[model samples]
Target: MTHTYKINGMTCDGCRTKVENALNTIEGVQATVTLNPMEATITMEKHVPTEELQDALSAAGNYTIQMTLPPSHDGHHHQPH
Candidate 1:
């Protein structure tokens, strides 16, 4: 399945590369990490646990990732109000 996660604390191309590298190193992760919007889109061969992803981010030392919100759908936006 394809997973899109909103990542925080990534501020540069270097950080972006770092995130990509970490996730790509995982056995099942085929990931593309972009810093412009601070997100990682990952395609996995199997279900990789979310904690494993968080562990990768934490190991990077400079990246702190958290789920913000999923993309808008059905022409409607979701806001926490």
Candidate 2:
């Protein structure tokens, strides 16, 4: 399965590379990190828990990762008050 995560605390290209390498170290995981969006998209051979991903990134730096939720079918992110 593939999953996208929002990464926080990345500030440069080097930061992006560090995150990418850290995540790719996991068994059966291929990760791509982008700086502009500050996100990582991972392709895994099997299910990997979000905690594990967070742990990997934490060891690398002061980075944090959270699962990215897909946009709603209605294409809206917020509701009227």
Candidate 3:
């Protein structure tokens, strides 16, 4: 399933990459993040707990979720983070 999350504190491409990389590091996630829109789209291969994803983003020290993207909209690619 693919999940989208509205995130905060991603100011630059580097910040975006960090969050993206962290999310990608998870066992089941394939993450893509946009800095302009401040969001991360995560594709999972298995059942990944939402709390786990949130914690990893939190550990990056600059991300907060505004809203979570539902699975039904995986193809709705938006603008920058």
Candidate 4:
């Protein structure tokens, strides 16, 4: 499913690219980030929790990501850490 998230701490295109790359690191995830509104639209093959996404973003930069909307479906949830 595709999910939208609000991203914070991006200051420029470079920062946007970094966040995008970081999010892409996770398995089965593809992310696109836009700086104007500081948001990301992510496509996932499986359920991935926000914390895992945060870990990837933290490693790349000081960015933070949170869901813009509650998940569409809670089914097939991946185990959380």
Q: Which lDDT values do the candidates have, in the order given?
A: 0.84, 0.94, 0.80, 0.93
14-42 per-residue lDDT for model 1 (tens digits): 88999899989889799899877889999
Q: lDDT score, residue 5, model 1?
A: 85
Candidates 3 and 4 compared by lDDT, better number: 4
TM-score of 3: 0.73
lDDT of 4 by residue, 8-38 (tens): 9999999999999999999999999999889
lDDT of 3 by residue, 1-81 (tens): 877878788888888888888888889789899987778888898878777887898888767754463556577667798
> Clashing residue pairs, candidate 3?
4-69, 34-81, 35-81, 36-80, 36-81, 37-80, 37-81, 38-81
Off by over 4 Å in 3: 66-81
Q: Of 1 and 3, which scores higher on lDDT?
A: 1
Q: Is 3 or 4 the stronger prediction by TM-score? A: 4
Where is model 2 more than 4 Å wrong at Cα? 75-81
Best by TM-score: 2
